[model samples]
Target: MCLRGSLHGPSRCGRNEGRDLSLDQPLLRIERLTKRFGGVLALNDVSFSVRKGDVVGLIGPNGSGKTTLFHCITGFLEPDPPSHVEVMGESIKGKGPDGIALMGIVRTFQELRVFRRLSVIENLLMSAQQYQEDKIVPRFLNTGVIRAHEARAKERARELLELLNLSSSAGKTAGSLSFGQRKLLSLASALMPDPQLILLDEPVAAVNPVLIDKIKEFILDMKCAGKTFLLIEHNMGVVLDICDRIVVLDHGERIAEGAPQVIRTDPRVIDAYFGT
Candidate 1:
C-alpha cells in the first residue's frame, strides 16, 4: 500500500547516466542515493538532476524522505555506499558540509538558522566573511588584507540587505524580528555566499500567506538571475507555481516526476500524497 517502489524503478531514475555529461550538464546530479537510520530506510536509491537556472521542487507526504534527500545532497548526512552526488559532473560523495559549500552549493534549514544575538547586518556580514576571507589567521593577525576583506564583506552584506528588503532592520537583533522576517534573513544569509545552487528545506513552512507570496516572488526573481534551486516545500500551490519540474517521493522511493501539470494528474503521485 505504501508503494515502496512503483513504476519509477531504482535504475530508471538515473536514466541520463550514460549520456555525455560534458554537454549541457546539470548543476546537481544525484545517483542512486540511499540513506538509512538504523533499520529505517529514509531514502531508497533516489536519483535526479537539477539543471542550471531551473527551480525544481521536491515534494511528498511527511516522512517521504524529502528532507532526508536534501541532507544527503548537501552533506549534512552521508548516504550509504554506491550513493553519489555530483556538482558540475564531479563527485562530492565524501565531501563535508563546508567543502560542499565551498563548491558553490549552499542551503537553508526548515527551522531558521539565523544568529539570534547578531544584528541583521552582522548576520549577513558573518556569512559573507566565511567565503570572502581567511577565517582563522585573518582574525588573529588583523592585517590590512583582513581589514579590506571585512570592508568588502560589509558592502556586500548591505547590498543583500537591500535586495532582500531587510535594509530597514539592519541594526535590529535577529532574534527580535518576527518569524517571517527571520525566514527571509536565513535565506539572505545563504545568498551571501553567492552560491551556484541553493538547496532550501521547507522554506515556506509556518510562514504567513502574505510572506509566502513575497518569498515566492523573490525566488522567481533569483531564478531569473540564473540561480539554480532545489527546494523542499509542502505547500502544493507554491511548489506548482514556482517549480518548473517536481519530484515526488513516497516511503523513501520516488513515485512520480514531470512537469507540474503532469504530476498533478499522475495517479501514482495522487496515491502517494492522499494514500490508497
Candidate 2:
C-alpha cells in the first residue's frame, strides 16, 4: 500500500485495488480476531462474516462485548498483533480508523455525533468530507471547484434525508430538532460515505417510534439496494422484524446463532436475560 499525491478508494489500497473482487463478496470478514485490554480479553476469539445484502442482528445483555467487537471491526480498538480484519475481503486491520472508513465501512455512534449548530444539510456536507479532493490549495483558492463539490454533496444529502423523511428539515438547524430526529440524522450521516457495510451501534435506542420507523424503512431500502449491515440493538421487535439472521452474544461469547424464531426459542437466550 502506497500513497501517491492523493488517496483513492477505501483503505490505503488505492482506487483500483478493490476492482478485482466481486461486488457481492462477503462485505466484511472477521476471522480469529481477539482484542484484549491489558489483562482481560474484551473480545475473545470472535469471528463473524457479513455478506452483501444481508441484515444481521448482534444481540446480548450488557457486558457481552458486542460494542467491543464493533470497536475492533471499525478500527476504533486494535486487535492484538498477528490478527487480521478484512473489509470486502481486503486486509484493513493495521490501516487505522480513517483508513478503514475509506475502505467502505462506516457507522453511527451509540450516542449521536453531529454538528449541532449547523443546518441539517451542513452536517451532511461535513460527513461527505471523506470523499473530498486532497489538494487543499485548490479547494481554498478555487471557489468554483469547492462550490461544485459542495452542491453535489448537498444534493445527495437531500436525497438521503428524504429517504429518512427529514427532507423538510434540510434547512433547519440540526440542534433545534427533536432527539429522535437527531438519531435519524446520525444514521443519514453515516450513509454519506456510500459504505458497503455499515455498523450500527444501537440505531433505535432511545428513539421515538416515529423516528424508529424512519430508521427501519431506510435500512430496508438499503438492503434492497444491496447494502450489508450488522446492527447492535436491544429492541427485540425491530431486530426480529428486519434481521435475515441473528447472532447472540453473552458474557463476551456467542451463545446462539440462527433464524429469529430459533433464537427466540433458545433456552440460552432466555436464561441469559429473560430469565427462565
Candidate 3:
C-alpha cells in the first residue's frame, strides 16, 4: 500500500523494506524482450536499463513498437517467454496492470484519458482510489482510516495540481479544459501514486508551443525532485534537451543506445529517422 508522504520525497511505503536500492542495479531493467501479435513482431530482443534518477528517451519512427513496449512494461501486455521485465531486480511476470502499479510503475497514454465528466481534483482522486484498503467489513468499522486515506490522497492531488499549474481549475470539469491542460491533468493523475518509474507517451505531441514549454518545465521540475522517467516522444528537441540518454528503435529493434550527443550524430539513428 502507498504510504502518506510528500509527493517528491523519498519512498515511504513498507514495500521496499528489504529490497535493494543500490546504485549497481537499475530501477527498471528489460532483458531479451520480444512481443508478437499474430506473427507480426512488435518488439524483438529489446533490452535497456533505467537508472534511479535518469530521464531516458525512447525514440523511433511511427510503429517502431514504442507503445507496445510501454504496454509490456506496465502489464497491459505480456512478453514472450525468456523475456524479462524487472522492477528493482524482481521479475514482474504474470503480474497484471494493478499489480505492476503497486510495484511503482505508472504511465500515461498517447491519447488523452481523463474523466470527461469529473472535476479535475475528482479525476486525480479516482486514480488514487485503487490503493485504498477496500475490505467491506473494515470499511464499515474503520471509517477513520478511510477518511485519513482520503485526506492524504486529496493533499497529494492538490500538490500535483499546483505543481502542474492547474490549481485554479481544480473545480472545473476535465472536458472544459484546453487540450494542453487536459494533457497536464493526465500527467498529474499518473503522479498521484508517486510511482518510481513514469512512462510518458508523447507528452508534447499536439500542444501549443507555449504549453509545450510548460510541460517541459514540469518534467524537469519533477526530475530535480528525484523522479525517474522513460518517455516516448517524437519531438527530438524536447527529447534531446531533457533526456540524459536515448534508445533509438527501428522496426521493433533497438538500433542504438547512448548519451544524447552520441545518439544525435549516430548514422544508424539518422538513417532510421530519415531514410537514405
Candidate 4:
C-alpha cells in the first residue's frame, strides 16, 4: 500500500509499533490552537485529537472560520504557528507546509488547486511534489533518471486514476473536466502521497448527488484502510453519514463535539446551524 516504503530501503522489523493506539498511532493532535487575521480572531484556542483511522468532521457556519483553521494547519497561514500542531507526538508548529506534508500529512483545498494545462495523469504525476525536484536534475543531465521518473509516475498515476474511477479519462487534459470531477481529481492527487493523515476541505461541496455518493464511499474506504482524516464540510447529510465524530465551531471557537446522533440533536449545534 505504501509504494515509497517498498523502495530501495532496508526493512527489518516485526512491525512499526507506534503508541499502541488501537490501530495506528495518534496521527494528529491539535492543542490550544489560535489564529488571527489583523484584528479578527479566526480561531480561538481550539484543541482536538485525531488518531489514525479516525474520520473527524469539522463543521461551522459560513465565515465561522473553518477554512482559516485549515490554512493554519497546512502552512498557508502563519498566525501563531508555534502555539499548536503535533504529529505522532512531535511538534510541527515551526515547520512549513512542505515540511508538514513530508511528515506524512497531506490535504486537499476547498478550491481545487490543480494544474489545468496538464493532462489528468500528468496532473497526478505533479502530485508527487517532493520527488519532482529530484527528477528534474536527472532530466537536465540527459540520464535514465527522467525515464525512471516517468515510469514510476505513470504507475502511481494509473493507480490513483483507477481508485478515483477516472481511468477512462486519464489522458484527457485536466482543464476540461467538470467542476465536480476536478474536485475528485484534487482528492486523488492528495492520496498519491499515501499520507498517514489527510485534512480535506469540503470534499463534497458543490458536487452532483451521484458524485457525492462516490466521494462518500471513497472516504469510508480510506477510513477502513487505517488512514486518518479531518474533514471540513458544510453538507450535514454527508457529514453525519461518514464522520466518526463531529466538532462544531461557532465564531471561531469549538462549541460541540460528539457522535453524529448526539451532535445532530445538540442544542448548541442546532442553535449554531439554525437559530435560537
lDDT, residue 38, candidate 2:
81
| Candidate number of the best TM-score | 3
Of candidate 2, the 10-residue stretch with the lowest lDDT total is 1-10
Cα lDDT tens digits, model 3, 1-276, are 112353344322211213454546899999989999998999999998998767899999999999999999999998997799899988899988888888899999989999999999999999987644346677678999779878988988888888778999999999999999999999988888778889999999999999898888777767656678999998999998888789999999999998888899999998998566
Top-scoring candidate (lDDT) = 3
Candidates ranked, most accurate by TM-score first = 3, 1, 2, 4
lDDT of 4 by residue, 121-202 (tens): 8888888765232445658697676677668777877866776789998988899999998998988888776788889999
In angstroms, give how far residue 131 of model 1 lies from its true place.
4.0
lDDT (Cα, tens digit) per residue for candidate 2, span 1-276:
111221223321211212333455677787777777788777766677776767899999988889998888888888876557897679985787788888888888887898999999889989999644367898989999989877777777877887778889999999999999998898888887677788999999998888788788777767665567899999999998888778888877777887787899999999995668
1-276, model 1: which lDDT tens digit per residue? Answer: 011111112211222223354568889988889999999999988988998878899999999898888888878898997798899988887788888888899999887888899999999888876654247775667778677767776776776677667889999999999999999998888887778999889889999998898788667767756678899988899998888889999999988888888899999988778556
lDDT of 2: 0.79
Q: Supply candidate 2's per-residue lDDT for 195.
A: 76
* Candidate 3: regions farther than 4 A off: 1-23, 131-137, 274-276
- Model 4: how far residue 258 lies from native, Å: 1.2
Could you tell me every candidate's TM-score relative to the true structure?
0.87, 0.86, 0.90, 0.85
Which scores better on lDDT, 1 or 3?
3
Better of 1 and 4 by TM-score: 1
